[model samples]
Target: MRAIVLTEPQAVALVNDWPDPEPGPGDVVVAIRAVGLCGSDLSVYDGDRAVPSLPWVMGHEGGGEIVATGPGVVDRHVGQRVVIEPNYCCFDCVACRNGRTSACDRRRIVGMNDPGLLAERVAVPARFTWPVPATVSDGALGCTEPLAVARTAVRRSGVAPGDRCLVVGAGSQGLFTCQTLLAAGAQVSVTEPHEGRLELAEQLGAKRVETAEVEPFPLVFDTAGVPAAWDTSLRAVAGGGTVVMIGMSRSPVSVSTRELVQRQVTIVGSLIYDHPTDFSATAAAVADGSVTPEQVLQAGSHPENAAAAFAKAREAPGKSWIDLSSWREESA
Candidate 1:
């Protein structure tokens, strides 16, 4: 089996003799069809974030079809197209019991700490995989994971129909966040340095600003994941408002305790997303045309050039995607 392995920091290798994945109980072996690179994947690659070990597989956002099922799996079947949730939580954990599975005591992200799907196939827990409509393309399905992240940020903000909101970046995450906020009936505005992204933000129904210098809004979303973006979000949010952090920046930033306390600001740290329900909502939104995740996709690369695909991810204006359908069960 061919797999793209992150052999070390800032380096990746294509190994044609990589070991094949085997499905365990309650798991399914999926013949991967597509993958989307995320900022967090770059963080792991740059050694800005630490996983359990090295030589790790390097993609998270993905979709494909079931090729084989393990024991105790009853719902999914071979040949069913689906989107991979990537994150799975232990049901018996305290967080799961309290309906906060994203914070479960025992949770693992498939492509970060564990083995990833940047390969010909992946064996993922059946509970973390969701079936998609037959009409959904593999590229569109691969965009589900990040879109789910955006949806989670909006849902966490608790914005009402008329609430004014500001998103601090116009990247893919920022655009998706803006679109999700609009779908929730909130008035949305965006701040970005890139002219092209700001235009795309406007096309997606968001007001544009050169920076976060205008009037403060009741809710602010920070997708830039940088210290400056965090500071700007803090300043752009109205007193007693909420600022949701949606990016995966590892650097530390200074904060004003007095300002934070005086204004009664509520800061939230949102990660990937919750299981079942969050993905369920995202898939539904994509299906009904309430959200268009595919709009953020860039040109895709085939498996033969997967290493080059990752090399170009950091520079892609939109979501960097890889088409892995060549390795589908039928093709394999």
Candidate 2:
């Protein structure tokens, strides 16, 4: 099996003889079809975010077919097309017991804490694999994980029908958040510096698109996660409004306590999606045509082009995916 291994900061190599994953009890080995390159993966590549260990396989969002199932895996079987939910949690944790698995004390993300799907195959718990509809393409199915993150942010924002909401950033997650808000009947506005991304926001149903300026909105989502964007988000929200922070920023930004107190502003930080429910809802949305994957997943790259693919994904307004199926064709 071949895998893309991050050997050091700003370094990646294609290892042709990487050991294949073997399924454990209650797990299955999936033949990865496509994997989505994420911002967090880029962070790891740039050495901005620290991982649990080094020399890790790097990818989390992916879709594939089950190749083999281990004992205790009853429902899922060989040849079932599925999407990966990358979060693994300890069921006995306090947060898990309370149905907040995303906040579990021992939660581990696939690419960060465990071996990821950037290889030809990966071993994952059967419970974390959801069968995707045949109507969805492998490229589209690879985007379900990010869509679930967007869904969680929207839910945390509590943006209802007819509410005015502003989404900061027109990146992949920002665009997904905009679409989700629109599906909930909220009047959505978007702020983005890139003209291509701003155009994408309009195509995704945003009522208004601005490079920097925006009128005060009742609900604001800060998906950019930069200090300047955070400052702008605070000023863009209306008094007594809510600001949902979905993007992760590496540096700390100073906030004025007096302004928050005077205006009765509420700031909430949203992490990744909640376990089964959020992942299931995102897949259902993709299947039902509520969320269009073609709008987000722009193109596919081969494993040999991992470095160039990451660069392209960073500059792209939408998402870019690695086409693992091409490896078989080339190797054959």
Candidate 3:
């Protein structure tokens, strides 16, 4: 098996002859099909994320075909297409018991804490596998993880009909947030400096696109971790409106507390999604034509072009698709 290993901070390599995973009881092995590159993965590569794990395969958003199943797994069989949940939680935890597994104190995110699916094959618990609809493409299915994050934010926002929503940043998660808000019937706007992503936001259903030239929004969600985004977000919030901070900023963000206090604005910080099945919901939405993941992502990238994909993502133009089939071709 071949895999992308992030051996340590700031180091990544494609390793060949990696031993293929063997399924344990109630576990399953999936043949990787497509993986979506996310900002969190970039944070892991850049060492901004402090969850200490090394020599790990770094991908949480992936979809694949079941190659084998372990004992006690009878509902799904070999050759079934599935999407990985990528969330590991201690069911005994208080948060888990409350159905907020994303907030479980003992949660270990695959690719973040455990070995990830950015490989030829990935082993995971059968409970974490969601059946992928035949109507869904592999690339779109792979994005279920991130879409779950956006979904969670939308779920938390308590968005009412006809409310205005603003998403700050046009990154992967930010664009998804915009789409979800629009789906909820909010008048959505997006703030992104990157022209390409701003165009994509418009394509994704944003009513207004704000660049350096545009004015501040009334309801704001900061999906870009930059302090500037936060600064703008605080100013953009309409009185009694909400601001959801969804991005990861390494440093402390300075905001005017007085402004928030004066406006009676609500500020909420959304972590990741809590329910493993949230990924399934995202997949269902994709399959049913509510969410189009392919429109948000560009074409797939081969191994030779893999570095370029990472570079392009870092440059902030568009999200990249890692085609596992490309690895097979490269090896051949």
Please give the range of 10 consecutive residues that has the lowest summed lDDT in model 2: 323-332
Q: For each candidate, how many residue pairs have backbone atoms clashing (under 3 Å)?
A: 0, 0, 1
lDDT of 1 by residue, 1-332 (tens): 88888888878787888888889999999888898887888877777777777678888899888889999999999988888888888888888888788898688887777888888888999988888777888888778888999999888888899899999988878888988888899999999888877888898889987562568888999999899898788889899999999975668988889989999999999987777799888888776676777777777787777767777777556777888777674465
lDDT for model 1, please. Answer: 0.84
Regarding TM-score, does 1 or 3 come out ahead? Answer: 1
Q: Per-residue CA lDDT of candidate 2, range 203-312, in tens?
A: 87896656455788899999989998898899898999999999888789988899999999999999997888999888888887878866876778878898788767
Model 1: residues with Cα > 4 Å off, grouped in runs: 52-54, 329-332
lDDT score of model 2?
0.86
TM-score, per-candidate, Cα-based: 0.94, 0.96, 0.92
* Error at 133, model 1, angstroms: 1.6
Please give the RMSD of candidate 1 to the true structure: 1.8
Can you tell me which runs of candidate 2 are displaced by over 4 Å? 52-54, 328-332
Query: When superposed on Cα atoms, how far off is each prediction in RMSD?
Result: 1.8, 1.6, 2.4
Judged by TM-score, which candidate is best?
2
Q: Which is the better candidate, 1 or 2, if ranked by lDDT?
A: 2
